[model samples]
Target: MNAATQYAISWKGLKNGTYHFDFKVDKALFQEFESTEIEDGDLNVSVTAERTEKELSLHVAIRGTVTVACDRCLEPYQQPVAFDGDLLIRFSDEEQEYDGEVLWLAPGETEASLAQYIYESIVLALPYQRVHPDGGCDPDMLSRFRIVSEEEFEAIEQEAEARHAQPLDNESLSRLTALRQRLEEEDGESEEKN
Candidate 1:
């Protein structure tokens, strides 16, 4: 089946009532679309379409796991996804943009493809930062990246604390004061020369 036909719903022939549909979305679907972010997943999508006198209401529910490369360690891991959203399809004499949740369908349009909406719903549900939880990432890969051990971190922190704790000695203070005086004298000589 064509990409559009694969997810098309023929609502024109159906009477005004409620209908249900179940779709198994897998790697082939993503490959057909040449999707880069998500190439492998086993998800079940349940759609409920309610046809009314002038409009159609669709409720989409998606559940399952998708494999993605971790942003931190670059290792593949399965991430669970579960979300539901609603959409409204309104028939129009002429094409026009409808705001939020509502879709405008031109006159004589008989079928609507759920592919785009279904794809977006799943992608938007994914986290912006894809990563493993805590220490779930591969330790060997993580080590290749810039990360310090507990002992090294502790040593650095202690060095900072010690530097802050120490006060300047009297001899060092005197040296600084004399240096400041010499710098001022040099400034005076330069002013005179100018």
Candidate 2:
């Protein structure tokens, strides 16, 4: 089934009542969205849809793991995700904007797709710091990106200037220069804040 129909619910014929639905989420979802942050996933979505005279309410719950890049080391790792939320679908004669809490639907529409909601919920559930557990990053990659103390940064700067050294590759040197500029900007900002 197309992703549009895979997770859709046909509520046009349903009487005012409660219904349950299950949908499996996989790498196909991320592929459909062309997601850069989430590479792959194995997840289950359970939805309890309640139909009323005026509106439909869906309680969605998702659980599983997704493969994403580690923010620190840029290596792929599985991150567990769990999300629970309620979505309200209100029908109107005019098409309206969908706020995060409520979904506006045209009265003529027969089905509502949960694909976008499921994708967004999983993404939102991810941590701000998408990194592996302590000591989980690849040691080699960590070694490539080092954060130095202010004094150590100055010492490295002095040695490079004094020796006219080009010991590092272009990529390494670029990374070092960027890091140095960021450190200087941070220090300047802090001094201004004081």
For model 1 the local lDDT of residue 5 reads: 79
Q: Give per-residue lDDT, candidate 1, residue 42.
A: 89
Give TM per candidate. Answer: 0.71, 0.74
Clashes of each: 0, 0
Where in model 2 is the C-alpha error above 4 Å? 147-194
How would you encode candidate 2's per-residue C-alpha lDDT over 119-173 as one tens digit per residue?
9899999987777876678878866865334566777667666657556557756
lDDT of 1 at 129: 71
lDDT of 1 by residue, 16-118 (tens): 9999988888877777778798859889999999999888899999999888888768898888889799988888998787554777787688988777777
Using TM-score as the measure, which candidate wins? 2
The prediction achieving the highest lDDT against the true structure is: 2
CA lDDT for candidate 1: 0.77
